[model samples]
Target: MEVLLAVDVRNELRRIGWISLQPNGSVSVGLNDRTFVSPDFKAKNFVWNAYNRVTIQYLISSDPKALKPIKNPHLTFHPPIKFQLRANGQHMLFEGIADLNIMLQQDGRVPWIRFVSKPVSELSKAGPSWNPDRTKILSIRLGNEDCSIGLGVDFVRKDVDVPTEDLLLSEFIDWQDYKLYVHSVAIPAQIATLSWYHQK
Candidate 1:
């Protein structure tokens, strides 16, 4: 899955820009002639709204047939693309928005991509408990069992007894990066493992 990043100002289509991913893994984004500077002007406060909205589009495939209509051909990013945003001069890391996922179509032809705007109370409901410093396990009660899984952690807990049958490890590889996800929730205790995984 590839992602393309674009942003538009409130109530104006004329004021729009894109974040381009360079071959060396650096990014170039600009609004008109003003280019975005990292660790300085970070992208932050992303919520879904009509004004000043950021659109994250997914490029399903690179085949010419998949590039249908050819509108704005530059909108796309290879999977595992990671970066940080400065929201209003404050350094807002990408992990701050880990809870959000791109909303995709159900037809299965294309995957979902997310659009973000300013934070609102209603939007918080859909967001995850984001903590860049700590990993969280979202729990649910299934009968008498405590079913919970860790997010933002790189390794499985050492003390927990994860059922071999229930454990799932999956990986997503792209041109620039690779990611791994482990699903093992049948364990009974809270476990702490390594932090996030990033491989070039």
Candidate 2:
């Protein structure tokens, strides 16, 4: 049986912009643009008069057909793909909005969704935590029963999207072993098309 990352990301699309938080994570989505079309109250007065107005936002996911293994020409490291997620709030909000809410009303479910995997270079190392640039190590463990696996993220597109990856050990190990495991398969990008409330 394959164990996949299971968690729901709830987003609050408010007047100013969209706000969301993962089940138990601090990383949240914020605006990366301001091209969103504002509601035209004069032309369609009833639309804005309604309570709990539904403003649509675009969600981008990887094209299942786009899934391809990360072929490295240098072959320095071939880490297993780790499941990860990311987003640029500004880009998604504008694109989804300009699409006339088509992407947000997907089968009455999520609008646009994609799935893609990440490269293995993101896996955590087993040796001492020392950065050439002297960046302090955040967490030394994967926050699981065994500390072999570690969770790391990839900033595929700084403002447009984010990819989340997870590291996993191939073999089970005791905590004392302190060995690193092979990263799990990376989860393709998923569009999080969401409806929000516009603050006017």
Candidate 3:
């Protein structure tokens, strides 16, 4: 399946070149870690004209890393990007300003990124609580299942003020600072899961 991702840059966060997405049952968005993220990879999102502004083709079964150009300069944060994904002649719209984020780490930077909501300080003192309004609505599976990774989209709607998504998280729980399942992604069980167990 070839999926097309289109977003409203005016109403949301600025979109960059390498910031691409492959629509599978996972996180379908990609951030341009170094090249696009910077001039300075951490502070500003300085992308160039070489970036693919609006044309994206995502095969549900392709390797996220296998896709050229989209696999480098990984960013540290993935906020819920509002977009309309079309696949199989179906259009899916995701609307919300995101406060939930997943930091994408270098393949070997630290094995995981921070999954945070409120400040770590607040959650520690008050204990952790799950909110429906805050149920992450991005279908970002941490491990792969013979599928592609990268920033792909697979969301489920849990009832609440906002919809809850399946983060497919495990291993550690810090509440406000939920330990990461993965900073990078792939769809196949071989690619992501193997890396998760072997490298981690």
**lDDT of each residue in 112-188, candidate 1, tens digit only:** 22112111111112122244234222221223213222211122222223233543222221223222222323233
Give the per-residue lDDT digits (tens) of candidate 2, residues 26-54.
22222211121222211111233223445
How does model 2 score by TM-score? 0.19
In terms of lDDT, model 2 sits at: 0.22
lDDT, candidate 3, 67-142, per-residue tens: 2221222222333322222222222211221123311121211222211111111111211224434323222322
- Over 4 Å off, model 3: 1-68, 71-73, 78-97, 101-170, 173-177, 182-200
User: Which candidate number has the best TM-score?
Assistant: 1
Q: What order do you get sorting by lDDT, best first? A: 1, 3, 2
Model 1: how far residue 77 lies from native, Å:
8.5
Worst-scoring 10-residue span by lDDT in model 2:
72-81
Q: Each candidate's lDDT (Cα)? A: 0.25, 0.22, 0.23
In order of TM-score, best first, we have 1, 2, 3
